[model samples]
Target: MVIVGIEPTEQNEVQNHYNLFKLVRAPNLAPNQVAFRIPPNVNKLDIRDYLTHIYQIKVVDVRTMNYAAKRPVRKRDGAMRGKYVSKYKKAIVTLCDNFKYPPIPDKQSLDEYEDRAEITRMNFRRLRGWKPRPQRINMRKKERYEKFNDY
Candidate 1:
């Protein structure tokens, strides 16, 4: 004889998959983005599919990191005990070209957004090999302190 636990339908299974939602990381990646942390077993391909099919983001690139465990102090009853924290993985996905986040006027405002965008464009030009604008030399210097006199 065999026993099987109650099996939920496909839709029910998918609803259960909502567990992954809770695992996603905070979405505070810069002004125009967000991020998520998934299981280490998830590869770049899987991540791309999830972003495309689930979140619907046009991913420009994906960066990953493998964490390693570290030893901890040993402690016990009137003694010390040793332990280690488990390792995990992380990823950072950059959005593709032409993707733009909707206006966050409440946070950035219009003027602030334009200033930031201009600075960003300048930075990008620099990265693309643009030379820095020439700087003007300051022609002022403080005078040296005079000798102190005591009465």
Candidate 2:
């Protein structure tokens, strides 16, 4: 029997492992550069190898920035106290080819999402004895209404 395409080799199997490389949007970056939120342990060499080997993309350069974790401060004493946010690393990778960012969702899709959220909220209220909390009143609208009532 003959097999089609490149056969799975031991090397391929070894390179098939998963690594966290989340693509992030950075409007300030150049067309050839892309930003990614990677694990703190991942280095520039690892990023270059991963992109070249897995995605078959030529990486020109990789720059990494480490962000320190933020600690919660006490409101009363103005002291640092509470759980710390996890530290993360951001990688700005420059590619040989230009990369175009994906388009944003239109207004119709946003309206549909709001409708679905409203339905879910109503369902939750029906199942549980949930009361709608009072929302903050807009000062402009309130003043306009007051002026109209005076007229």
Candidate 3:
């Protein structure tokens, strides 16, 4: 019996692969350069490969900057405490071709996006049994004194 070999296609090569490369808006970036926020563990080679394979874009050069995690500080004593913020990396990829940034959404679209995001946040808080903070009312000094003087 004879067996035939099949070459892996681009789709087959990256089957079920998921990598987070968040596009960052950098107004100061050159037209040929694009910024992305990647995981700290991702290397320059990985970034190049990811962009080339996934986006079908040719990368000329990739520069990476790693940001250390920020430790939480106590509000009163100003001492470090609580959980530390997650570390992240930023990659500035120079492309073979000039890159044009996508157009910003209109006000209505932004409002809708914010509404959806707020709903998701509220759902998450509900799942975590989070309580909403009391709303504060702005008042004059005399009004505030009168309101609190009874207590």
Candidate 4:
């Protein structure tokens, strides 16, 4: 491997590794919006700054979300458990007006993006398979009224 400047050391290597982020492309997402996988502890302001300062990209907004590890189990009795999946964080960055992201040509990266997007779509609450039952309580139907007694 070719070293650019100083010889790479462990401390520098770890710091460099933290700079990694993957670009995710999806048909459902807006053109200006770019999705990427980042470290969980990273905040939105830092992400925005990273793109703008390091990558020279103008960012309008940065939205972040964390995905919990999917630990599968049996539906009937919840006894059988599958392999553990590590949780990860994803960032959806909105770029400045009319700025289009450079197309990623890496086939493997493209495929990974598709898989991540599909997983996210399935995990969405509105379209999820198992939905929580709506509460049928003493809620006002058409008019608002003060509670008469303890609920």
In order, what lDDT does every prediction score?
A: 0.50, 0.72, 0.70, 0.62
Provide the lDDT at 113 for model 2.
69
Q: Give, for candidate 2, the lowest lDDT window spanning 10 residues.
A: 1-10
Name the best candidate (by TM-score): 3
Of candidates 4 and 1, the better by TM-score: 4
lDDT of 2 by residue, 1-151 (tens): 1111213343533343345677788999999999888779889998888777655678999999999988787777777688888898999999999987666658665746645665677678868987643241245346657997998
> Which segments of candidate 3 are over 4 A away from where they belong?
1-18, 77-84, 110-151
TM-score ranking, best first: 3, 2, 4, 1
Better of 2 and 4 by TM-score: 2
98: Cα error in model 2, Å: 0.8
* Candidate 2 vs 3: which has more TM-score: 3
**lDDT digits (tens) for residues 1-151 of candidate 4:** 1112213343332235545576665566787887887667778887876666555678988888999988777777758778777777888888886545564567755646645554565467447665533331124311223543423
Off by over 4 Å in 4: 1-15, 74-81, 97-151
Ordered by lDDT, highest first, the candidates read: 2, 3, 4, 1
Q: Which of candidates 3 and 4 reaches a greater TM-score?
A: 3
TM-score of each: 0.40, 0.56, 0.59, 0.50
Across 66-96, the per-residue lDDT of candidate 3 in tens digits comes to 9999888777776668888789999899998
Please write out the lDDT profile of model 1 over residues 1-151, one tens digit for every residue.
0002212233322322532311233346653334445556667776666656544557877777777766676566545456776665666667764433333347454446644665676688789998745231111111111222221
